[model samples]
Target: MSEEPPYVVSPTADSSSTARPATFIFLHGYGDDAEGLPLGLAQQFQFNNKMQYLKWVLPNAPHNHEAMARAWYVPKALPNAVKPRVPGHEGEEDAPDDEVGIMQSVDMLDQLVEQEIKNGTPSERIVVGGFSQGCAVSLVWGLTGRLKHQVAGVLCLSGYMPLQTRIQQLRNERGIKDDDKDPKRWFYVHGTMDMLVPTRLFVQGKDELAKWVDKENIEEHLYQGMGHSTNSAELRDMLAFFEKVIPE
Candidate 1:
């Protein structure tokens, strides 16, 4: 195991604002780390004058292989199933399922969110999000009833839900029936052309999430001809979603 990954803070942060700033925590995609997402966002938004005070947190995944690529968890191949595609590589076989890894990331995230709550940020003012593998972990965090109130919103970009069976099992254990319509502050966006975590999985993720959250509360978007990545249009909508969910 490696040491904890470093985090990146956005320069757009308003230090002069007296009010407790709304916090957005982003988990990086596989093989990537903390600085990239915030840097990218900074490039676009540039902390525009109209935007409210905000704090962005981007955490890097621990280094994995010798090549220095970081993975949230090691993908495991299922019996007779095609190998899952490797990160940063296209046209690869299906990768294996790794619930253990997903949960481990969840545990780490739980601490991160809890720390924010302890540091004077309200649960409703915090938004958690990720891309690809990061997205999978964020979904797990949302599905967990214990952590449901810990965040105001979840942003999933070019990602899919993992450990579906375990989520249902836990829900059952908690006596949360399928029809319970809770707050659907989750915003999930995917590309229709995504072959890695196919569009089918994205749909399945939405359906499973619907069991807990009211359909009307959840926001879904699809990018036509887009691959396993995000686009400018999606980012714009995500900003809008945040403004509504977190507010100024």
Candidate 2:
């Protein structure tokens, strides 16, 4: 069978001639197309015009399971029926190839960001973010691997690290000290009641991640009563966080 083409959502600014100051690349969760959550945020923020200075690109994940549904990779089925390892959860069987795919996504994103920069977007103004499975990939790529290009920050919503053991491997391979204080660059957002991924995973990941980086570099926000989805409050807080990290 021929390979399915990748997808990207391009929301342009009011003024087409001027280059945006930065770009935000959104990676969607499993079974979700690039048009959902990211598009919601792009509209909410009116990022195309309000932040006319910023360019928003939402890239759809590859089609899997013949549904044209998006996913970073084929997920490993889970043991507990209540906690199915379908799309969002990070289970052990998901280690090997998922890790590789996450890195590949980062590289691909880096290239896209570089192209934007060459077109007039600045490196320090770029941001990467996503929800659920998308968030998991963003977290792993932001923390473990080195970007060929630097971004302003990363936003990981309702997601957790996939492979915990790879922390040391990532550090050893990339030569990044656990305590290195460059700047607070990673943001973790989750609903306290999100049963899909569970808030506990974030706690666990953070505890382990602390061994390699300053806790300050990672900012966490818990939304009470929210589930595996994003609410208005979450979006507002996310926009606030973005302002702090990528101020014009």
Candidate 3:
């Protein structure tokens, strides 16, 4: 990551106004820097006037050298029994301590949201989302983090649910009440043909997640014929989801 890599914000409020009703914090996936998808989505949201009262924040992930390129975390080569038929590309650096790194990132995002609130945005109007690995991290944070600062919504794109045992620990550690209540604010999405994290894993993970919370709380959208990346339809659906969750 650049010492001062850009943290882009495209606000929808009038030029002279500093306050917005909502904020969307976007996280990018592995091997991808922060600029592309988040910026694109922000542009789309701006043009379509989706959630016109919301502002978009695209935060760059801490960089690591892997696959001769930058990556969010060091790629872990899967064990033979669990490896994908076609292995994904590997990058430099040791495997990430995902739980710790993600929590740290969440802390950073929380600070950003707090700053916005200081500038007049409400805590309830803040949303967090991400692509692929970014999606996984956001989901984990939303379900486990302190809810005194309740977020408006969360978007998980092309990602799988984290391991069940970890979620159990997170719930316990956070003292999150209503563990049985599903996370109604969550929007889960996955690509049917995602080779990186197979859709089957999501199905299995959902089943496990139900052991901890009501299945009704989480909404899922499985996009057919899509691989590891987001498509136009998914983008439209994401915009609609955000619009519905965060009022203009």
Candidate 4:
């Protein structure tokens, strides 16, 4: 129905607020909510003990009729009969951009980062990440949020960026600098056989990311034979990325 408070994990779920040294706000794929990503992660890896000091914030996408489920925004090309498309190939990529809801979602997620700051963690210690649809929103927010420069890193897992044609225009409107030498770290992971965000879009997303981010600051990996979802190897890479960006 409505967006609720995020699912939070502070230190050990019982630690004090002051114990938080870094934060990771991860978003879920379409149809998933605050509960999904963590459950999925737990099934894949046991990083909670190692990442105990990092505060975790998982937000849910609001429900909407157009999405037919929870989603960051409604895709312009709605799915046909049988099953709802999960925003991959099909006509979703080439359709005229539906950006109204995208911008709104960006703003909401930015507020979540701001609230973390108000709670004592600096933006430099914050890492925003997501799966599928959530990854798209996280990347957009990192690039366009008013506090963009202050944030630490972005984690994109098997996702593609939307508004590719309009990103530069949006940046110009927001007065974002064309070249900021000290860009935040970014990790991008996608499956080679991913039809959801197919290879064409994946390459396109990387090229788009290169425009704003330094090539050296971005880490990319393409898993062989993997599909739309993640694997144990991907989870290992995630843990390593977490260590690199949010080190203790």
Candidate 5:
């Protein structure tokens, strides 16, 4: 229903450098548009000198007429059941089951990566990141893009693993060996008070990921009194993570 561009780009701060720049692709949460928060942050925010070499791409999710929202994929119609449900937290959203639609969005993200590659950044220099629904899409794509290249890092903000139920099948389809580990570095940051994805879901996703990814390769940060949204401290830590993985 709304009209926004397909994507927004924030050029690197140090454009004077001739060497290939790193690219950080960001996807927005459900019902949100990239032209708003993501793009504005990308254009204005800088953590440290390490960010100077990072170019940003924030893409808008395709509109969903059924939900009347801009969503990466439609949320599951029914919430999932939790065993031994917590006393006050029995209700949680178990989303990211839309394989077909998630993959389609991955394909779309792949195009952005391909373009970045053509422009100069290699696959290893690219990072995939997102918030909430965007985070879910990025996770599935980072693991199963058709290009078959492991990206440098993934930034997950207040989100859970979408295809948690089908992770094994996804691994089999991608020819991933049980003992094989990926080159991608994962950084997961969540609010302890988050209600949307819930801390339990984060634990579930983290456990599932540890089966395939080494514990050393993943970093997690939990913020108290925070909700589904991000705050200054989380952003600072994220910048620190980027500095470690991809230096300017």
Candidate 6:
């Protein structure tokens, strides 16, 4: 199979012809392509002369069971008899155990990160983020150190962390402490009404992550009525998060 190509979103033409010093990579949700979002997000981003140094990369997911759709991992089948009380909240209860597919996606992302570093950006200046399934993989990369690089930050939107039990096991085995003193900043934005991943995941995630990272380093926001999608408020907050976390 041919490797999937990623979409790139750059600063305005008048901004600069110079190379960017930092890179932001956002993975698309399942069933979506890479084109629309990167550009949309770029447009919504705080655009300024200083922002010209930022570059956005969005990669497409691999083809999955859905007709003409792409997914990062092969989701386990869920019985149709069970339904979520709210729409779009299905599959929130499954274990994060798609090791084969998840590992493959992680490898691909790691290569992308390495390429970005080789191209000019340093590991510390690169941020990896995603929505939903993308968020899951990004979470793995950020928390598990699977990227083999310490990223500047991780942005997780309306998503849940997979392999929860494994993570807990590792923490127990390694004596890793979860505290409010982690130096790296991680931004998590979720909707309270999100049925897809559920709000409990975010709450549980924050608490569990705090055990490994500094409690202060973790920043989370819950939108009141939002669903399994992004909104203007989140974009505005994201821009601010970028400004605070991404170096000039």
Best by TM-score: 4
TM-score of each: 0.82, 0.80, 0.79, 0.87, 0.84, 0.80
| Residue-pair clash count for candidate 6 | 11
Residues 100-182 of candidate 4 have per-residue lDDT tens digits of 87888888878888999999998889988889888888778778877777778999998878888888888888888777545
lDDT of 3 by residue, 1-248 (tens): 33544466656677676544677777887767667877777777678766666777777776554333444444354322133221344331234345655666656666666676786767777778888767766766676766423677778887655534577677777776653443336777788778777787667656664564456656678899998888888888877787666766
Q: What's the candidate order when arranged by decreasing lDDT?
A: 4, 5, 1, 6, 2, 3
Error of 6 at 217 (Å): 1.0
Please provide, for model 1 over 119-211, each residue's C-alpha lDDT reduced to its tens digit, 9 standing for 90 to 100.
Answer: 777878888888988898888888764555657899988777778778877667657666664453989999987766778878888998877
True-structure RMSD, every candidate: 4.1, 4.2, 4.5, 3.6, 5.0, 4.7
Off by over 4 Å in 1: 10-20, 47-52, 65-68, 76-96, 172-184
Off by over 4 Å in 3: 1-6, 13-20, 65-72, 78-97, 147-149, 178-184
Clashing pairs in 4: 88-196
Q: Residue 124 deviation, candidate 3, in Å?
A: 1.4
User: lDDT for each of the candidates?
Assistant: 0.72, 0.68, 0.65, 0.77, 0.73, 0.70
- Summed over model 3, clashes come to 3
Q: Estimate the overall C-alpha local distance difference test score of candidate 4.
A: 0.77
The TM-score-based order of candidates, best leading, equals 4, 5, 1, 6, 2, 3
Lowest summed-lDDT stretch of 10 residues in model 2? Answer: 1-10
State how far residue 101 of model 3 sits from its true place (Å).
2.7
Instruction: Report the C-alpha lDDT of model 2 over 127-194, residue by residue, as the tens digit.
Output: 88778878877766676546522677888898777767776786578776665544537778788887
Question: What does candidate 5 score on TM?
Answer: 0.84
Candidate 2's C-alpha runs over 4 A off are 1-20, 47-50, 65-68, 77-97, 174-181
CA shift of 126, model 3, Å: 1.0
For candidate 5, give the lDDT: 0.73
True lDDT of residue 205, candidate 4? 86
